[model samples]
Target chain A: MTLATPPVGEPRHRRGSPRGTGAFDRSRRRLYLPFVVPALVLYLAFVIGPTLAALWISFHRWDGVSDMRWNGLDNYSALFDDPTFRTALANTLIILVVAGAAIFAISFVLTMIVREMRGRSFIRSVLFFPHIVSAIVLSIVWGFIFEHNGTVNTILSTVFGTEPIPWLNADNLFLMILIGTVWISTGLYVTIILAAVDRIPRYFYEEALLAGANAYQRLRFVTLPLSWDVISVAAIFWTISSLKIFEFIYAFGGTTNDMPPPAVWNSALFVYGESFGGRSPSYLFGYASASAILMLVLFTALIVVLRRLLRRDSIEF
Target chain B: MQMRYRRRRVRAAALTLTVTLGLFGAACSADDSGGGSAQQFTYWSMWQEKEPQAKVLAKALADFEKESGIKVKVEWQGRDNVTKLLAALRTDDVPDLIDQQYFTVSNAIVKNDQFKDLSDVHDMEIPGESKTVRQVIPEKYDQFTTTANGAQFLIPYEVIGYSIWYDAKTLPDVADNPPKTWQEFADVLARSKASGRNPIALDGDIAGYAEFWTATALSRTLGPGGFYKLVSDKQASGWNNPGVRNALAAIASLAKQKYFIPGYDSSKFPAIQTKWAQNQADFLYMGSWAPTETGTLAAPGFKYRSFNFPTFGSDESLPASVIGFAVPKSADHAEAAQKFIAHFLHKERLSKISSEANNLTPRSDVEVPEQLEDVNELLQEKKLSKITDGVLGDFSDFDKKVFQPLNLQLMTGKITPDEFIDQITTGQRDFWAGHRS
Candidate 1:
């Protein structure tokens, strides 16, 4: 009927065509690759392009208002010796290790509880609500809370009779920032992990149960392996985000207004303060650009390493 | 299950807001009274505050609208006042009148050449207000109003002063008065600490609060004009200068003194308002602006007064850094704006501003509001109410460059006075060289 279907072993498409489909397959190409160009353009313009420009600017010094001077790694050289920069780097690492670990572990446990819930959607929204609010707005709100005579201390003094702690001190500045960040962002991860947990079929659990596998055994064998890919992706995201932690810290603590947030100046706040924290020198925006470049490098390295550890064979379940 | 699930997405938020169209409609009543020249001029104020000062100004505008037959439509944009003026400068359609930050007068001149020199206008105005303008403003503020090219930028709007604000109730039974000298001041604070009260309730997050106390105190010690030269000169930015080092060391010594309220740098500025409100701390060295409602300093039963900050070095030569406002050159309704400027300085309007929350008016015609104790005392000096550091005139970019960094260094204990002066000089030299090119 169709010339015997081009024989059993014959190709369905031309050699160069994907899935053996020809280039003339207009409708199929239109349906599939329509999304590709837009996504590519978005990634190029916003992500890849700005990154390269930031890298270029990092070598020079320019205040946002003035002309640029190509310092040729002078900013980088200065950054290495700069106490503020060192503090920021250490702070970023501490946040990544602490918040990253906590967010993931908590998300897993919460997902386990939430997955078996009756009001699953309601619980999911509650967890994810903070993620919808902008970090800057949230930080401002938190600032009111942690402010010297804020509500937190008012309650503490009234209820437990504790004195107000130096919540925004150099010693605990990063900790307050971390606590705020964790509260706002962990919900998104929990939701992601929950979705992954949902996709694992009940059949696997039933089969495991018949095999006399307990809840812990069923979870380890069925849930953990199935959700490993999603959990790994979440970790990679948290790593990148932790490296560029700016809005919360920047809004939470101002260098002029607040003690430079325990000198744990994430590179974002570091460059920002250098550019315009009231005492900025002649607009060496070039140097700010340079710090941005270095941050990109650091973030890229983190992503690469995480990919190596979390990288795995695409599961065939 | 499906019905229950569907209801979650369709639910309304908790707070139910009534539209109240009737109330809103009543609030939008139009005024049509006219007495004189029906000049419909547009005006703008930088502050969108709900304070009575704004309301009084609005009433005056309405009165002016009734008297002059000039309906002033004001578009108020609220945010950082100076930043808004800078944005207003880059456009052609600007309001006829503007109320902007006092420091912006310099940039206003450089950005646009459209401003009608108020001095020229001052000379042209009727003889009645001229004497008032001349008498109220000191020579220093006159210098500030003059442009780089030497023209009056704008009339004085408001004057601010800063000093140590103390809870009068918390004064120990032993100490009779606020300290007059740096050592006495330190001792008084130590006494306060010994008495189980925070000696200083400075903000935790701001470096400026600390800098203000130490700098003002040091200026009192360092011959009257010493700190003024530091602000105007460029070489003093390095932490190497002796005075710069002295200032930082002084502040650092205070920081280490343990008499400062705990969490000094981490506490937000307004939170200090509460600390003082709750009588948790004794002294707050803040702006004269604090007496205003905008500072939110006045809580119910709020009792406080200002004293001259205890001095380390005397500075008779420089005035306290005061903030004011000016309309920029790109103003659309320049004549109406001029009228508004004049209105702001008029005796009744100025008095209203001064009386409301006890704000200071630079107009010599008006007496100091009774609520402000410091200015009332300073008014007694009558040694020409000198404006802040640039009252004589604004400095070039280089001049600002020279001192800004040194000021930071001085605050941080990172540099000495000699180094600070040297940096100022170097910064000035660099700025001068750049200008020459």
Candidate 2:
């Protein structure tokens, strides 16, 4: 009787057809090539073309202005041997894995709590606010909160009589940045997971409860399974976004004309520091390009591996 | 029915493509229409549009336009001028005149042989002045004028001298009698610390700013000539120089005494500077630009003052550099650019630059603003030293790799004086080895 049932008496293809389904399908198939050509041309011209160009440039020694000289593999070898690049790579990975894990775990906890709260919508809106704000503005606010003579220090001195903490020191800067990253990213994941969790029927939770399943058990047996697909997609998204984090760290220089100290540099900062950065730019185009390509390759591999690991069959209600 | 639907869909797609292609073509044609008349000359200034220098230069350019009956298109590109210039040099859209810091041009762009010879501008009359451009500027700036190939590449305009700045309202005694000896300076710092205050407020976020303390100490201890020799000489044992050790030890002692303000190593740029302006800190080591740079954030009645870093029984030579204009080799209007430079150097225009821009004009005859009287006096005294004592002058890489990192560690008390020197010398030796190979 339903539209999906395709009426009981008609053949499968013709049942739903108001205007000759077979002929319409054939015509649509004929239109696909012409319809797709423009988009494919654009994609090739903008995305794939520049990517291949970057790969070609990565093999040369160029200052961006002068003639490019071919020096195959030398840039790659130099990158691995460079201590600054190593630090940048390590920082980027730490941001990707460590900050990412914290974001997911915290977001999951927040989702669980917000799901049962009376003012759930209000809480979700508040949590989502930081994500929508500019990263540069967020970084500036974060800096002021943690500065020595800033608000936190003022509160500590007056209320607790505690000495000020050096929250943004070289030893502590990357850690502070990681914590800020977690704060900013948790909201988006929470919203995503909440949306996935909301799709589950109320009867599923009621049945779990009647069967003597506790809240944690229900989360494991009901909520998590239903949301697994969305969680996997979110994981891949986080992996890519975390690698491109530059503005949040770059703004820490706070009116400085030069790039931030190398201690907190990520791959993006590394690429910039090598070319068209600093008071006097080094402009090592080939070196910067090689680093960029390395990041692309690493991110591509990570995304693929993540998809494989987080893959799950959809659960139908 | 199928044929009608197919025809409609194909028409819609064709319409969308046509619209997109039309928009793109419009954009391309709009960009292509930017070429101006042949009588126009373009200038790209390195100052932001709102900066005092940019305003003064715009007015001078306007005056030149009126006098010469030539149209000049000025672009305020700020710090992006260097990058844009490099890119534009490869194309026909290159600017006729580009303003840049002398050190930046000499260090980054000069070796590329892109700048035209500016020797003719040296003898050009300074508009209505009886003096030629060369006669007004001191011979000391000649160091920046001539490129490695012995061709003049820059016309020095706005000069900057670096020194230790302090809030006069807070430290009237130190301001009255700025310490002239290292021992005296240390005593002042010790006294300031003993009175429950930090002596120095450093924005250690900028490693180069932190390096100033060590550079000044080395300059004083080794003298300018000795400091240059130590930096330029390729000897593996450059760090073994007694002056280098003494300078590091002196910086370490300040750290040992906890003379820097709390969280000095971790504080962001302008935060420490802001605190210094607020009279919360005793002294700040910065360039002459500090006053104008921090003017908006300074507390009420804040009197900004500066003095040369105290010496160790040697002549004081404060760090100095010049920011100026140069014509590119491919410029189509080199004569117009030269005329602009000559007009810019006129005594009347230079005086306005000094007064309105809060800049130290290179011309000795122009009177500096009251805020920069101290810097002008030092310049008149001929006490300005090359930046970093001219150390790392020939080796620009050493500033980023060797000097800044080592200086930051030293400032943070993360590394000892001995460790600082060892790391620097090792870095220098490795750098030379790589270059030689």
Candidate 3:
């Protein structure tokens, strides 16, 4: 029952070590800084530089074209009072938590069922297909399914004798979007969990069965623990990706070329709507930036907490 | 080994710093070279290249190039030209001419002072016509040309009037005898429903479409100035105006009676418009562009005609908007851009825009396409009014907070008439309070 554990806190390279004397290790060390510095420079210029600029912009009043005026904390204070920003913030959290939980739970169940099936590869591929399709296309198709007099309504009326539902109305739109996000995201998580599950040694499951453990017990003791690290990583991925969901929701506005109703807007949509969206772009760059920076700070804190909650001692194999 | 590793790290850091500095240097020096003998200008158009307006503009540009010996580079940036034009204004590279809807220019770009004053163009004679630019374009279209600061910033190129459209084939009798009063309109809807036809097809997915009904109703009930008081004046009592409640209630009753096509609330955009074109509904309230925008989706031989939105007692103005073009302040070839504008507005050229493009040209002398003959009649009769003119320049916030949300709720039957008024009044008060500080 012994699990192989790699040294957690040990440095890869120690001065005068026997391993460091190897030619490959020495050459790899020599090339490491050269290879990493290029990408690091780009990352700083494009990602970090703009982020810092946004932070600076958040403290000023700007319309993208006008000379920026220092507004101190006024923009930040205004965001708290903005009803649209509050709705966007609430929507972002719901997608991150509710949609994330649904995606992982569904993926895990599907992965468990498909692992031992005869056509497991086909089923896995079929489930994984949505991950590759552009989210805008998926959103359009999803809208059609739930649209009044759409596929869902037609089926309900002819087969079940039920009335059509207002699936895309203001009160119900965000809920429908949450469900659509879960449906689109589950496949990718299932594929990742399945890969992790496949890596677990077959002998561990066999031993669990030999000890008279039931199917659920085997999954609980062996499979779950073995895939814990991957699951935690997936959780972090979902958090970051969920905060950036824009195109799918933006498409929901249809041919109108206007921003979606504030009730359904997430933080990303809020940034655009405030700054450069709407039929006539608002150009409230400072206000938009304040909300954006606030969301980033909140998201960063959530990610750190998630990592701590999901942390566990890793088994090498 | 430690010394060698430190030396390698230092070398890598130096190399990376040098490369980064070199990249910045290259970016700084990348400027357009400037010695062309030929007269050249760059134009960014808001219309897609294949759209009828763009096609006619392209023909006009070609004619201008041939006659004037100007090499014009045209970029079809489509609906995003306003944002692109704004960005371009901040940089050295800019388009000599940009086309945008009049509302966008007045409310977004011109408000920000991005466009050059084109008042001189108003006095310039058309290239091949006897009239000056201002003489050919009717005075009603002047609302779109003038900015908040009283400067003429853009030229109105197309005339767009908002009204109720009906397919002659679907409701032949109604098309011939359009509703002219609130009660008549209501009775028409009821009769249409009783005859097994959906009275209206609304693209409710976009809240703007739903807001149109409220805007028209309010303008009719309150008169244009009173409607402006309700939306733009930011006075809380504007919402308390009995006319405001009645207008909202009128629209709400349509939803209450299910006069709109079933499932309109959940229908995808253009889907409801397509349904209207297919004659699934007997009527659609839309802009003058409705015929052209939905023409392809129309049932075969579906002839479309539009009439002014029927008035409530004492209200008679038809809601109108305009689409047009402008030159940016940063333009390098402003003179050439003006020349191009004058050429495009020539009587023959405008006639082509009307005939070939199936659009309502702003020039009063140009004969409109047969499809828009009804709309032209309204214009000729001087029955048009700016539907949302009251809030046009400074109502973006109120639009988002009050108009858009409550309109959707009212149309979807989520709120009563009283609740709608209460929410809007409270919302407007809070919005103004926040801005006042």
Using DockQ as the measure, the top candidate is 3
lDDT tens per residue, model 3, B186-251: 999999989988999998987777878888788788777666677665567777777778888899
lDDT of 1 at B318: 28
Error of 3 at A264 (Å): 0.7
lDDT of each: 0.60, 0.81, 0.82
**TM-scores for every candidate against the unseen true structure:** 0.72, 0.91, 0.93
Candidate 2 per-residue lDDT, tens place, B159-207, comes to 9888788878888998789988888889999999999987888888777
What level of docking quality does candidate 2 show? acceptable
Instruction: Please report the candidate that would top lDDT against the real structure.
Output: 3
DockQ of each model against the real complex?
0.18, 0.34, 0.40
Residue A183 lDDT (model 2): 89
Task: Flag the better candidate by TM-score, 2 or 3.
Answer: 3
Q: List the pairs of residues colliding in candidate 3.
A: none
Per-model fnat list: 0.23, 0.31, 0.39
The residue-by-residue lDDT of candidate 3 on A159-245, one tens digit each, is: 999999888877788888888888878989999999999999889988998999987887888988999999999999999999999
